[model samples]
Each structure stands twice: as C-alpha cells, then as structure tokens.
Target: MATLDLTQENFESTVLENDFVIVDFWAPWCGPCRAFAPIYDQVSENHLDIIFAKVNTEAEQAIAGSFQIRSIPTLMVFREKVIIYSQPGSLPASALEDLIVKVRELDMAQVHKEIAEEQAGHA
Candidate 1:
C-alpha cells in the first residue's frame, strides 16, 4: 500500500477508522526526513494490511503540533486505535521490519490491562 497523506482534516477519522496505522511525521526540507522517505515507502509496500501515512510537517503544522512532534522523521505506530510505538529518528529497513513484527505480535488485551493497572495506580 502507498503511504497516505495525513492532515488535520482527516487525522481523527483515519486514526479512529484504521485498526493499524503507521504515521511518519516529516518534511521535505529535513535531510534525514528525505533520506527516510524511501525506506518508509518501501516498508509500506510490504505491509498491505496496515495504513502507512505521512504528515508533512511543513504543511500540517497543527496535526504535527497536536502530536507534540519535536523532531522530523518521527515514526508513530498505532494498533487497535492505540499508540504502540512513537519515537524520533530514522530507522533502517531491518529495524523498521523488526518493529512491524513486534507490533504485530503485541497482545493488545494485555497491553490495555497494563495501562489500566498503571492508571489505577496513579489515581
């Protein structure tokens, strides 16, 4: 699947509707972002079931700000409408593939249970 162009207009709907989404926050002006674009696109092509998306920081400032993106080339992976991974940096193809595998293997029920327990403890 090709990467979707993400914007504030469709951000909520996309995130709410997709079971799995991987968003790349980037801008053309950033050297690292440019270098990572192809890698991200290649990874997207291999994962047809996942929604691979891109948020052009230069264009979608609001959406980028909403996510508190402090750096370009940040990758965020969402599964079951929940964020499973979010971090700044460009990952190599192997690392990206490893991340996808880990995300797929995650037990959401256990993750949610852990989140709930942590929240309950805080409260």
Candidate 2:
C-alpha cells in the first residue's frame, strides 16, 4: 500500500479507525525526513495490512501541534485506537522493520488492561 497523506480533517478516520497505523510526521525541509521517506514507503508496500500515513508538518501544522511533535521525522504507532509507540528519529530500515514486527506481535488485550489500570490509578 502506498503511504497516505494524513491531515487534521482525516486524522480521526485515517488513524483512529484503523486497527494498526504508522504515522510519520515530517517536514520537507528536513534532510532526515527526506532520507526516511523512501524507507517508509518501501515498508508500507510490504505491509498491506497496516495503514502507513504521513503528516507533512509544514502543511499540517494543526495536526502536528495536536501530537506535540517537537522534532521532525517523528514516528507514531497506533493500534486499536490507542497510541502504542511514539519516537523522534529517522529509523534505519532494519530498525523500522523490526518495529513493525514488534507492533504486530503486541498483546493488545494486555496493553489495554495495563492502560486502564494506569488510568484508574491516576484517577
């Protein structure tokens, strides 16, 4: 699957509705972002089951601000409508592939339980 462009208007439908989503926040001016783009696209092609989306920080400032993206090339993974992983960097292709595997293998039932427990504790 090709990488979809994510924006403020479609953020909910694109990321939240999907079971597994990988959102890449980046700006065109950033060298690292450019370097990572092809790797991201290649990975997207390999995983047709996953939604690989990109948010152009320059054009989608509101979306970037909502995520509090302070750095370029921030990668966020969402599963079951919950954010499971968020990091700032241009991951090597190998690392990115590894991340996808880990995300796919996650025990979402346990993750949700842990999240609920943490929220309850906070309350």
Which numbered prediction scores highest in TM-score against the true structure? 2
lDDT of 1 by residue, 1-123 (tens): 789999888988999999899999999899999999999999888999999999999999998898999998999999888899999999999999999999999999999899899999999
lDDT values for all models? 0.94, 0.93
Residues 68-96 of candidate 2: C-alpha lDDT, one tens digit per residue: 99998999999999998999999988899
How well does model 2 score by local distance difference test? 0.93
**Which residue pairs in candidate 1 collide?**
none
How accurate locally is residue 21 in candidate 1, as Cα lDDT from 0 to 100? 95
* Models, CA RMSD each: 1.2, 0.9
Q: Where is model 1 more than 4 Å wrong at Cα?
A: none
